[model samples]
Target: MTITLYNTATRSKQPLEPIEDGKVSMYVCGPTVYDRAHIGNARAVVVFDMLYRLLRHEYGAESVTYVRNFTDVDDKINARAAEEGRPISEITEETTQWFLDDMAAIGALEPNEMPRATAYVPHMVKMIEGLIEKGHAYAAEGHVLFKVRSYADYGKLSGRSVDDMIAGARVEVAPYKEDPMDFVLWKPSDADTPGWDSPWGRGRPGWHIECSAMAYELLGERFDIHGGGNDLTFPHHENEIAQSKCAGHDFANIWMHNEMLQVEGKKMSKSLGNFFTVRDLLDQGVPGEVIRFVMLSTHYRKPMDWTEQKRVEAEKTLVGWYWMTEDAATGEVPAALIDALRSDLNVSKALMEMHLMAKNGDAAGLLSSMTLLGFPAVNQNLSPSLLEKVQRTNAAPDMLDSNSDLQLFQKKLESLRADALVSKDFSALDDLKGKLGAAGVEVRMTKEGVTLSPGPFFAIENLEVLK
Candidate 1:
């Protein structure tokens, strides 16, 4: 099977031709681990995870190497540690586990290698030294900075001239630097900050250099794909390419960047009140499967918007799918699904095919397709235990108990719905639905039946009015 991806470096969709046939290498930028991963971070993780699954499917699982690095050492981590009055190690350790747990909850497969930035400090220092030797970098005042002008093709990835970049970008202005366009390779760490002894001084590696070093050490000089959010395409990735190429390393061949995410058509920010972490949503009784479904509904190249309506629809759809495949036998995956994914990770199209399969009552085919798409379907051949775990996690918190009053309300709603269908009037049914929603009971009505489950804000006392 051939896989074509839109390469950020080349600005075109190119077929993935690995340097070594049948062997694919992928590296995606992981989290900084200073706090819980927000929705935007989860988007990048899920996007690359979809690609990882596709690569494993096309190339044998053993033939693929996926590396995602953790930025254990950063200014943000230090600031958090200082604010909490805790050790840096403790902060990094706790937040790192938080990242792993949250990502796992969303069905993201772990990369083959998760190198820590601190673990690869020596490699970063060595690379910096080589850049200095090659005249691409220089040391001043115990700091090493990459000379942006030293590389002629500095802005090729971003497609901007030096003057334009300097004018448009947020280039740090330091008195020790030779030029404003130059980026830091190594910076001096103070006594209170984390530092490693290097040729320049007791300093730490810069953020951009850490990835370049880790990718080279793990995936070698050349690799197939390098991925991250599009926000990094500017100074971060541009700097990585300049230093890596100057050191005579081929580096990554294909660059894939997923678009940023928004919440309800607005940028997610703490000030906007829509900003939330993955843990926040999960804690609020939103199923991980539902979150993944909403994310994959949009194309990776396009911006994804998270809204309450999408969440409700996703939960309803998944409930129906689970019911359909409950008694299904394992079957072959649909070829059309693979075709959609192969065409530049067209997950939206693949989701459409699954919807069609569900519509046609192809239970076995739907089950297999859902499993391949990372849903927790019953994979009798592989992991039967997954179904049980998913069922437990997907259950809403404070699920409605089938008591006499609740049952009466359910029956009344069913009768009202039937009456409304026959009389062609829905005001009464709509009012009852609104009441149930206010009580935090999710009312799902299908041709077969109606189901009421507790939502995140479920309050049993609120049901007294219904009685």
Candidate 2:
């Protein structure tokens, strides 16, 4: 199982040949714990998640190492804590849990290791000392700055020259900076801010240094892959590469960056009233599976547009797919589906392969492929009682549950079906179906039984006549 990934640094797709046979290592820049992660943040997560699955599949699960760092120590976190008048630890801890829960809801697997920045403060201080000793960094006014020009190939990762970057970037005009391109390795923190006692002073690390140090400490001097959203490509990744390479570490072998997200063909922004978090979508009755489906509908390298139409189509598609595979047991993952994913994580093409399997009514094959893509044949969002029943029985009949009134009406419908058989008249059954359909219930009549499922527009008010 050969895998090819688009290396952003090289500007071309390359076959993955790990430094060690039968072993692979990768790192992805994780989220800063401040608030609920928006949809844009989720794109990088889903992208890397697919890659992780592919790597684990190719090189046995035990052989692949994946690390995603948490930027727990940040100015945004401090501000959030100040605004809430609570400790910084409380904010980071709560938000970290929220991030994990939301990502899990969308079916993203947890990384092999998640290193928080604050926990690795000693390593960061050590790395900073190395950079200063190597003349790649200097300290002044209780702040340490990376001398950007000290690394001649500073912009190699981003494919920009220093002059061009300085011209384009809004570089700070601090008197402490040796040059406008110099970035902070360490900055002084106020008494109330989150800081660690360092040789320079009591201060926290800059955002870029946190990732560089953590990746080096966790993944070692060099690793196979490094990933993040394209928005981080410029200053964040560029600065990281400069710091790592200057410290004489080879760093990552390949760079992978997923493009940002859009909503309704426009840049998603709160000012535009188009910005939404994953929880917001879930709260609005959009299933997490729907969010994952819409995300994979487009290529990771391309901007993903989240429209209501896409959401509706995704929901319909999943409903149909889950139905097709309901009775199917696990089967072999189609060779073609794996090939599609191996080709630069082309999930859009992989999903198309899944559609072909479904079209041929190969439910077992489709179910197997869906499992590889992290979509379960069964929805995990059912109620507690329904979920227990599903786990015990390995089936969620219609995946529906409701109040006694609705259950009583369903029993009434079942009795009507039984009598209609004897009377040789289905008019009563037909009428009941119509009324239920009007109330936004999907009615399925089978020789075995009648099942009622509520849809997106289900309304209790419309089910009154059945009373």
For candidate 1, write residues 1-467 as lDDT tens digits: 68999998999999999999989999998999899999899999999999999888888789999999999999999999999999999999999999998888888889999999999999999899899989999999999999999999999998899999778768788999999988889999999999999998898988999999999999999999999999999878998899899999999999999999999999999998999999999888787877888888889999999988778766656665666686788688899999999999999888867766764567888898887788876443222333443366444322123244466788999999999999999999999999889765678999988877644333344576677
lDDT of 2: 0.84
- Score candidate 2 by TM-score against the native: 0.82
**Tens-digit per-residue lDDT, 1-467, candidate 2:** 67889999999999999988889999999999999999999989988998998898888899999999999998899999999999999999999999999998787999999999999999999999999999999999999999999998888888899998778768777998889889899999888998889999899999999999999998899999999999999899999999999999999999999988999999999999999998897777677777887888789999988888677656655665676576788898989989999999999888777755654557888888878888855754432332343355433223222344457777989998899989999998889888887665668878888777554334344465666
Tell me how candidate 1 scores on lDDT: 0.85
Give the Cα-based TM-score of candidate 1 against the true structure: 0.82
Candidate 1 lDDT for residue 325: 83
Poorest 10 consecutive residues by lDDT, candidate 2: 393-402
Q: After best superposition, candidate 1 residue 74: deviation in angstroms?
A: 0.5
| lDDT, candidate 2, at 132 | 98
Q: List the residue pairs that clash in candidate 1.
A: none
Q: Where does model 1 exceed 4 Å of error?
A: 378-467
